[model samples]
Target: MGTVEETLKCPVCQDFFTDPVSLSCGHDFCLTCIQAVWETEGSDEVPFFCPECQIFLPSDVTLEINTNLQTKAHALLHQQRSALREHTVVEVTGDPLSLKCQEHRDELKLFCMEEMVPVCCLCVLVGMHKNHKVFQLHEACVDFKTSAADFKERISDKYSRIRVVLDGDERLMMQIIDAEEMYMTEWLEAQRGHMEAQIKEIDSLRASRKSLLQEEIELRFLQQIKAQNLWNPLDLTPIQEVDKDLCDLEKLTTVERLVDDLSVALSQHFPRMWSHLSSPALDSKSAHPKLEISQDRKQVYWRTQPVSEALSPQPYDSQYSVLAQESFTTGRHYWEVIVQEKPYWLVGVTTGPVDKRDALSQSSSSLGVHNTSWCIYHGYGQYLACHDTQEKQLSVGKRVRKLGILANLQKGELSFYNADTMTLLHSFCVQCTEPIYPMLNPCIDASGLNTQPLTMFWIKDHWDWHINTEGAKE
Candidate 1:
């Protein structure tokens, strides 16, 4: 009885009853807890009892009675007991039968997904773990520990890369702003100088016209006086007549020339002044100002793209090392093979004038767009100039759809791509130091509507070598 008081709790009503009842089976529990469960079944005398053990009661014994054991159990509950509560305090919170492990007395940390109970790892392995889902705390902790370190490293690296990109963007913006300010200042000064010069020229023209007008008026006045004196029958004073005519002529010429010069100056200056002042607004649409810095940090061609109109491509025949050049004779027709090793081709097309230029540059302008002509599709695996051909400005007929493979034995890498799309289609490692001779076959159809591409070959040192395509075995 003392052992039962220390360990077991009722499954139905949870509390340790004053009187403990023993069923027909060996199981025992509080009498009140079983009675309460019986009442819930709505029977005057329950056909079954010991709800905890589910044992049947005797049909002949139906009376409810009190026993001396009830008084003794009640006195034991109020007495000083063990640290692990000896008396059960009835609770309605959750499952009443659930209890800590009897072996270690430890709260279970593992969850049995099947039975929906917390258990220790040992209990799961012996009972709940067979053909059922179980979660162990130690396993979860180990998995999280491994993932946490990797995530932290990734986040740290990402932030560092973002900072570098932001710094570069800030530098570019500052350069653009500075270049625009300088360009505006220079333009404004030039406009002011031109306007001032025009104004000075207008003033000079007015002075010249004024002098000519005065001279004409003086001569006419003198001629009028001379004719009047000559026709007079009565004698007249020459000085008084000349003085009166001269005064009237001076007044008329002054008013007439002043009005004419003022009108001319206003008409000329109005349009010029307005144009000079409004030039800033018009200048906004002009090319974006740029700054070019030399190796020594000195200003070079400011507010200009690095590319120049006079720029020409250097010939590849001189710059690159030729791997093989073989010529064959087929009677009248000459068959030839020329293989050259170079950095992977930056293939493009252009449609502009191509009278005198390298074959590559001519192809690009006729086919490629600006900025899209410098893509490295294979070796470097960049997609820079991929979209240039799609632009409407680039002529459609001058399309470049030829790919060049670059196999660098020194670097142990092979890079190849689609020439038209500038997409990196292949990249792998090479083992052999010797150069690989890629096969060449001329396109059968060369109709202008769907022009055939030129076959390119790379022969390594005159040997009949073929690309070993055995999963990078070579």
Candidate 2:
């Protein structure tokens, strides 16, 4: 390949970049391949520098892709791939071995992890699985079986814990209900016995009165009536009345309330689980001297005059920006910002605080201007996704009043969205071992036309952005 052709190749991978980015020194490279080289080295004591140039560079140097060069490189790569495709003879089962390739029919003892298929040695060398991760078929089976066993055991343990709680609660509730029922039954039994005794006494009184009426002499009947208390108008008295309520209704209400509280508690569990996914409040310590951080530290705006207060010897943010204090190392996270009519703005995520000695020049301090962060920049009408010193111009259909950023470190993906409609604006694949934090820069006011403050959006109740527009209406 000529020098021009070699220019399209990354120094680390020596291949055309699927996604290209340039360092501050104007050296182009594949973003993924370079990240692999940098991330694997894993030594902070050693200075971060370009592989090809061997020049010392800022540990957090910005990286942004040159689209024109990226296009040319990809075009060249496609041509090469097409040429390779034409020369390779794709014949299957050439040796008629026991484990032959399905397509080419060569010996298929290796398993392609990426494609989840068995392939011959030829496929592993130069076919579709050439660049993919592969292993012996037996090794893949053993690994997957071990993983399945571990997952099953974990799931069963979780279920067991949940079942124990549920069973304990069920037993307690049943005991209470049974106790209430038994108490009511005993009371009813006592009332029934008393009513039966009263009925027996009434029957005996009537029988005696009949005997007195049958007396042959009127004098005898008068004597019997005078001796008996029942003779006095049958001693008129009412029978006992039944109770209005059979059981305590209040106890039932208490049980219902307990259930309602459980429902509410269960509903809130998920929000607490993923609460870190929301935006962390901004760090005032990282804010520039010319910016004012809100009392809540969720907002930042430029002041007409730089603040007279000093934030100690630590370097102030050089890009009129504020970064998040929290350093997230694992899990999927999401955050949003309210830009609302701002003519110039930058928003994204960055690394943990670096010492003053590692701080970059003011120009290079801008988020996305270095490899340590990824961000979107908007000035005038243009939108760009920036990393290192290179940028890719973005096409936005409408003005973005708010922005959404999603960081899935496990997947090495950072995606930007238009928060209003949640439409994708841009995305980046990042693989860095350093912890990351959110960042924002409401660029200096442009001739008094752009003064709106940038705000960290407080996501409510599981990403349901029911943003109240009352503030906007005002």
Candidate 3:
């Protein structure tokens, strides 16, 4: 027969079960242990398989208590406790409890500091830890405890410092938000007031024009009544002159003139808003093999040679395009590109770290698709603003030579302007979370008609602005 201790012990925990329960397969285990096993197996709604027999139990199956097993476990535990109590009494009386090595059956006098284990004299001579540094067990224990306490204290100090830094950062962020809110509110209110005043002035002008028209109408009626009998054609000249003047006044009050005036006002107010002119250089590393970058890194164009084989491992498969070396994360920046009648080209900004392999496919990798980038595409005789796979056709009358980009990250605005004419082409309001890089695609034409290099204008200091031939060094 098996020993009482072995018979009462649960297989799951290898200890006497507090509440033994039997499964459908007649296997007994601690109630908590079986439940924990089922939970770990992820069988909350489904039946779980038995650990030993692999027998499936129903989800709603009730657990039955193994009373006989529980009784045996309790008796065995009581006997063990009684034996422990007797040993405790002996130890209390003056006899010290001695620790012995399991393998050698000798007193463990020395401890291996390197291995952190107690060993006997025989163990030190021939055991696996024979070459390990040895120390007195009591001394090693005290040293480890003191080191653990020191580490705990250091951890506490670091945690406190982190909390203090986080608190300071939070306060700083709140202050910044408060200042921005106040400034925006004031700016908006001023704009509203200006618009209201403009509306009143327009209404007054309309009233004056209406009065002049009514007076002319009444004068013509009187002239017709006097000329009804005389029938003289010379009197019609004065009415015709008055009508021409009225037409001139109507032209002066047109919507087109109003829009032109507004544009002029805005340009004056926000002149050089982006003081920092970022002279972006072409990044050769991200350029395609078919695209040739200038030595000065200011221009990029389509190569004459066919791109059958890559000179180096191409970073991206956007075979006609290249990105700028510089990227913008915050603040306002302005840059100009001189296309100079490049019929086919793409100029814009990209939230970079563009995947090289994925850019091979045009449909997915194009600048505007999926909010990866925004750009102005010039194809043949038309201009298009593209973003998120959508294109907006721009009505540009003349061919654009110089393209200006004004990016204000804080204001969440990106504007494109015809630099030569100083006319706004398109603007985008985007919430960008990543750094944006200027991108260029000097498209390859089969006819070789569109080979003009896309050149970037480099500005020096604010006082003396000059185009640097070798591009921006920084």
Q: Is candidate 1 or candidate 2 better by TM-score?
A: 2
Tell me the whole-model lDDT of each prediction, alpha carbons only: 0.39, 0.74, 0.72
Instruction: Quote the positional error of residue 354 for candidate 1 in Å.
Output: 65
Top candidate on lDDT is 2
Model 1 earns a TM-score of 0.22
Model with the higher TM-score, candidate 1 or 3: 3
lDDT of 3 by residue, 391-438 (tens): 899999777888999998999999999987868999999788888888
Candidates in order, TM-scores: namely 0.22, 0.38, 0.38
lDDT of 1 at 338: 21
lDDT by residue (tens digit), candidate 1, 1-474 = 547555344455555554566555655457676667777875875476555555677766433323444444555565546653654343232222234543445556666666655566567656545556767655655655778998999999998997887677557555655665577567667766766776676677567546555755777756754754634563422221223442244433554565567558755644321121100011111111222222321111122223344433321111111111221111111111121121222332112122222322333233223332222221112233233343222212322344544444456544444434544544444454222222221111111111122233222343211232233336
How well is each residue in 283-368 modelled by candidate 2, as lDDT tens digits?
77777667889998888987765333543322223366777877788877888899976778888887735642233334545444
Say which candidate scores most in TM-score: 3
lDDT preference between candidates 1 and 2, better one: 2
**How do these models rank on TM-score, best leading?**
3, 2, 1
Ranking by lDDT: 2, 3, 1
Stretches of candidate 1 off by over 4 Å are: 1-46, 50-143, 149-153, 156-160, 163-167, 216-474
Off by over 4 Å in 3: 1-274, 307-319, 354-368, 460-474
